[model samples]
Target: MKSTITVSKKVKEVLERKKKEMEIKLNKPLSWDEFFQNIFREEEERIPKLTEEEAEILKDLTKEDRKNWRIREFV
Candidate 1:
């Protein structure tokens, strides 16, 4: 199945440039789906995961504390 999506000209141009760059670097052609999948995979690997103990501790935190902790951790 195929679907259509609309984007601004600037966004389309940027994506086309990035697609070309990725295809050259990877030495293969990529469909739009594959390009997005690759990007998501790289992003998933870059973020940190908390352990079970850390998750439980977070659950006990007040809203303000949780917000502060996230700011400290991410920034």
Candidate 2:
């Protein structure tokens, strides 16, 4: 199935330019769907993944603990 989406001219131009650049670098043709998929895949790879135990610890954190954790992590 196919669907149509509307975008501003500026957004359309940017996407077209990026699509061409990615195709050249990747050495293959891509549909708009494939282009967006590649972009999303790259973004997902940049996020950190935590183990179950780490998630549990986070879930149990108090507001103060979370604030302290953010300060420590960022600074």
Candidate 3:
């Protein structure tokens, strides 16, 4: 299936400029979906692995913070 919708000349020019920028940045042109996918994939790859202590801290974060809690005791 094919469909076309008219856009303003300014909008078309902006799109062309953005396309050229993206092509140069990525070293190749990409479809809109491909650009988003690459961004998400890069973000997912950059997430740090949680340590045991960090995991425990995340698990222990209660609805309210308790006073005088021992951090080393939990560790």
Candidate 4:
């Protein structure tokens, strides 16, 4: 799983800076796999992975369904 792609020097520098920023932000040095996962993984699982455009198609819902549907619930 080793490959290389050309990137501009500036782009490479930005990526390195971002890696440092994420390390400080999360209080951990992220592995390459985990770093990409954290960057690309869905931000939340509670919304069924629908984009804002996709969620606008619903035409009907139950009161309970409406009340219970949330991106994330604290309680």
Identify the leading candidate in terms of lDDT: 2
What is the alpha-carbon lDDT of model 3 when measured against the actual structure?
0.75
- The residue-by-residue lDDT of candidate 4 on 1-75, one tens digit each, is 987889999998988888888889999998767776777663554446666665555433454478887798689
lDDT of 3 by residue, 12-49 (tens): 78877776787798899887667657768878989988
Clashes of each: 0, 0, 0, 0
lDDT score of model 2? 0.91
Tell me each candidate's RMSD, in Å, in order.
7.4, 6.3, 9.1, 12.4
Q: lDDT per model, in order?
A: 0.90, 0.91, 0.75, 0.74
Q: Of the candidates numbered 1 and 3, which has the greater TM-score value?
A: 1
TM-score of 2: 0.73
Off by over 4 Å in 1: 57-75
**Best-first order by lDDT:** 2, 1, 3, 4
Best by TM-score: 2
Model 3, runs deviating above 4 Å:
31-75
Stretches of candidate 2 exceeding 4 Å from the true structure: 60-75
Question: With candidate 3 superimposed using the best TM-score fit, by how many Å does residue 59's alpha carbon deviate from the native?
Answer: 18
Worst window of 10 by summed lDDT in candidate 3: 62-71
Residue 72 miss distance in model 3 (angstroms): 46
Relative to the unseen true structure, what is the C-alpha lDDT of residue 49 in candidate 1, on a scale of 0 to 100? 94
lDDT of 1 by residue, 1-75 (tens): 999899999999999999999999999999999999998998999999999999887776765586676434554
